[model samples]
Target: SAWLGALAYGIMKLFGPITGLFVMRFNNRAALMLGCFLCSVSTLVSSFIVSMEVLYVTYSVMYGIGASLVINCVMVLANSYFDKHLGFATGLVCSGSSIGALVLAPLSHFIIQTFGWRMAFRFFSATFVCVGFLNCCVKPIKRKRKGDYEQDKNNTIENEMSFEAKVSKRPSLFRNRAFILWVIGTAFGMFGYLVPFVHLVSYGVTNGIPVSKCTYFVMVLSGATTIGRLVSGRIVQKGYLNSLHFIQLCMIVIGVLFMILPTITSFAGLLPFIAFLGLVDGCYVVLLPMVTCSLVDYNDAILAWGMLAGTCSLSVTIGPPAAGALFDIYGNYNIAFHAAGAPVICGALILFFIPW
Candidate 1:
């Protein structure tokens, strides 16, 4: 299931750029609905698969592609409507993910225990398809006529030229130096970010923590992330800090936390660390969109965000397995945690050197 989740996210990232373009070129509502439908269909199909290869195709590839569209289009829609408070809106949109984690993990766990895993997938498939239906409620934001873009009567020709030049000076998504730095830094930052989510339960079990208690770690992470997203969004919205700087700050803390995660022996000791990680990771998620909004012109937010996600998707796909492989090699999660954290520190350094 863990590998399946990662594979889904990775596939989503792979499809991100194309989905992004679809949203930008057409309507977010339509794109989002398409994604939701595909995901629902894929999830439904997964319930019938009995072989590994079939599971890979149905869940990992098909489901992943659909999920990616949903993730990509949601942000694009958020950015489209909320310009000044884009961070706040994005935070709210991303908070839905945390909330889903908080509720669904436990519910799915319970369902698997009570019935069977296939039933759980079937249940979620129904829910996901319902969401696709709900997407029909979204209405497009009415754009103004082209005449609204005409020069003001009070403006001189030279002033109009200057304004045009200034607007044009804001580089396109591919050409923006700050955006490139953001992508590069975020890629490295992602390399170790998923380690805790994937390994924490097993690591705790090995150290004698009860499965029941360790399971709530997911809740803890989700709760903290919920709070962190709201707070980080507000910070960016209010201009308290640049989105990139806030992201780097979170990464620095996350890096240090990963290094310390393996040293704790008690189940109780793990709580605070996991909570803190959740908060920081939540902030990281919200800031990713905020940073994209900050770096690009408003018209290009969706495209830039898609590209950014696509870039980081490479690291997202590789990070967990890389950490797991280290665990196999070293016989302890100590090296894995440390290894996961090291690149984030470097990613932060890269962000620090880049003049946004």
Candidate 2:
């Protein structure tokens, strides 16, 4: 699963930029539906795969292609859908992933116990197909013409007729200081971000905690995340709370909690820390897209979100293995936790200097 995720993400780097640019120029609705169709078809194919190679091809390659398209498209759509409550809207959209994890974790075990893993894939295929078809109901928002661009959304009118002319005429995203720093800060913070969750059970076991207790810890973390996603939405609605400041605060809290992990002795003692970690971790997914939209024009959605996801994919690829290596070398999780937490804190500090 780990290697497949890495392969899928690495391949995404190639396809994501092209699809993202296409999404920016053309119809977001169509591009999004196409991605959903691809994802649904890949899921269906996964149901029939008997070999590891086939699984990798379907789940990794096809699914990555589908997801890359869908993510960029949705970032554009969500930016347009709720202009006044964009942060809340983004949070709700991202919460869908966390909600899926929350439900599917237990549901998968139940399904396997009742109908086996093979049947679980069949069920997943059916569910995804339904979701894809349902996504077609999303209404298309027409893009402003070059003539109307000046009056709409502060965008200037550009008369470039040729593809090369248009390509040469587009604004330089790399020159934007805020955008560049935000991406760098996110890339750093995202490194080792998910490793704690991946290793929590093993950490518990190493400390002589029972298996059942460790499972409960996982449940608590998931519950905390669900609540955190919702709460962040509400927090964003408050005019006094700056979105970037809130994100930085959450990161600092998460880093501090991770640093203090060694001090927890009992399940009750760990409960608060796990919940705090979830609450802080929730900010990244909920706030990132909305913040990105605020930084750039709505038309820039494809490139912005695509770059973010691609950067996030790179972070995910590098984070866990680095943490594992630290553990392997030290024969302890202290170094790993410290290493992970440091980047998060540093990222938060970097955000303090950023205007957004």
| Best-fitting candidate, scored by TM-score | 1
The residue pairs found clashing in candidate 2 are none
Give the C-alpha miss distance for residue 330 in model 1, angstroms: 1.4
> After superposition, which runs of candidate 1 have C-alpha atoms over 4 Å from their true positions?
1-3, 142-172
lDDT of 1 by residue, 1-356 (tens): 56777788898987878886777556788888888888888878899889877888899998888888888777656766776677888889999988999888878989999989888889989998889888888887745333535634533443445534643654567678877887888888888877778898988887899998888888898999999998888988888887777888989999999898889979888999888889888898888777777777665677787887888888988988988898889888999999899998889989986776
For candidate 2, what is the lDDT? 0.74
Pairs in steric clash, model 1:
none
RMSD of 2: 3.1
lDDT by residue (1-356, candidate 2, tens digit) is 67776777655654656676777566676777777777778777877788888889998899888877776666556666676676677777776777787788889888989998778867776776777777778876655533664565433334335555565777877677888788788778888576787788878877788987888777778777877777787788766678888787778887777778867757777778888788767775677776776676656667777776676677777887888888899887888888888888888788766665
Count clashing residue pairs in model 2.
Answer: 0
Report how far off residue 77 is in candidate 2 (Å).
Answer: 3.2
Model 2, position 166: C-alpha lDDT score: 65
